[model samples]
Target: MGKVYIVGAGPGDPDLITVKGLKCIEKADVILYDRLVNKELLSYAKSEADLIYCGKLPNYHTMKQETINTFLIKYAKKGKVVTRLKGGDPFVFGRGGEEAEALAKQSIPFEIIPGISAGIAAPAYAGIPVTHRDASASFAIVTGHRKEDAEEEVKWENLAKGVDTLAVYMGVSNLPYICEQLIKYGKEKSTPAAIIERGTTSMQRTVTGTLGTIVEVAKKEQIQNPSMIVIGEVVRFREKIHWFEKQAENAYPVSGVL
Candidate 1:
């Protein structure tokens, strides 16, 4: 019987991919990938692998999600090993659950290989910690693109005010409105905030400021998506306790999680 693997490609850098995920890609006969996935990581796939783009990019959606599910089931039924290569951990805002659910109905055997989520990795690459000893103790990872925007408005506000830190994935477009909502819901204007563009890759750029100004700052800096937004007192730690500056070989975990 053929098998399917839902693999995380890490934030962007090829080397950041988990060894297990790389091995799966190397063996895959069909590779279905997301928008933000780095091409370097695709090199792990077999030379003859059927590479399919299965994401909605800036304006192009080579294959919609439902089609991707159908595509996976189709190829899997052909007794070919398939890989759904995604950016970040498949379970973390990756919509991996939906694909997995669809696969289950088709009785497709599958495995999930987790990778470093952009919610944590991007901030780390930008020298920000989701949690800090004195600054923050808890964080919420929210997707900028939610199923229900208005319904989620209050919830996002609650999270903004309640959670020690807020990391918004794919949130670059909604920054202005989100910050406005948070400020209206009693979040402090001076709350430290940052926007990291194309994190964990050579193209990574981080812009830091207060919640009140980061929107304008990011626009001025021309920071784009495929990024992470971190907002909290913990954002201040970037000045001192940073470690993931890409010294040489590996990305060392930063200190002071306590």
Candidate 2:
């Protein structure tokens, strides 16, 4: 039986993929990659490798999760090295755990290669640190998406009063609801907030505002998904140390999306 490697492709930039992850792609006989994964990295794969697209969009899934699991099993059982490449750290809201569980049930041999998650990488690219020595001592990564009409399970109370910083992913759609929950749970309306769009890439755009006004700001800027929402005092540091935006100005200048 062949082995399966579930690798994180990193957030946006192709160069950020870990060495081991790259090696997996180079050696794999079959590769199943996701939508957010940077296609540029595929150039490293063997020319004979079979590339399969498993891209998923919000409210739409190009390939079902079950289908992906079946493909991994089928490829590995055929004695072919299989690689399942995801956009961010496999376990970090990338559904890597689910895939791992599927493999375990089938007794497939596999290794998980971790990649930099967008939650942290996006903020850093936008010149916002998720954690700061003085302003923030704690951090949390949260999902902005939720089931329609489902009961909310997020602990907004603690998130508002306890956590020093919050990195919210895929939350552009529910920005207003998120802000409302935070404030309803005791977070100050004037608390700093920012969203980094297409972060870590040449097309990166960052917009900042307070919890009270971010909704309007986002509407005006037309920010969309694949963005990171950062909330906390650490966001204030952007004004003084925002480096990526400067780099883009001098060298990278907002080029078209990759």
lDDT of each: 0.86, 0.92
lDDT string, candidate 2, 1-258, tens digits: 999999999999898999999999999999999999999999999999999999999879999999999999999999999999999899999999999999999999999999999999988988788998999999999888865553573577678888989999889998998999899988899999999999898889999999999999999999988899999999998998888778879884565876
Q: Which ten residues in a row have the lowest lDDT in candidate 1?
A: 244-253
Off by over 4 Å in 2: 147-154, 252-258
Runs in model 1 with CA error above 4 Å?
58-60, 146-150, 243-258
- Could you give candidate 1's per-residue lDDT for residues 77-161 as a string of tens digits? 9999999999999999888999999999989999999989999998987778898788888999887764555777778668866
Highest-lDDT candidate = 2
Q: What local lDDT does model 2 show for residue 60?
A: 93
- Every model's Cα RMSD, please? 5.8, 3.0
TM-score of each predicted structure versus truth:
0.90, 0.95
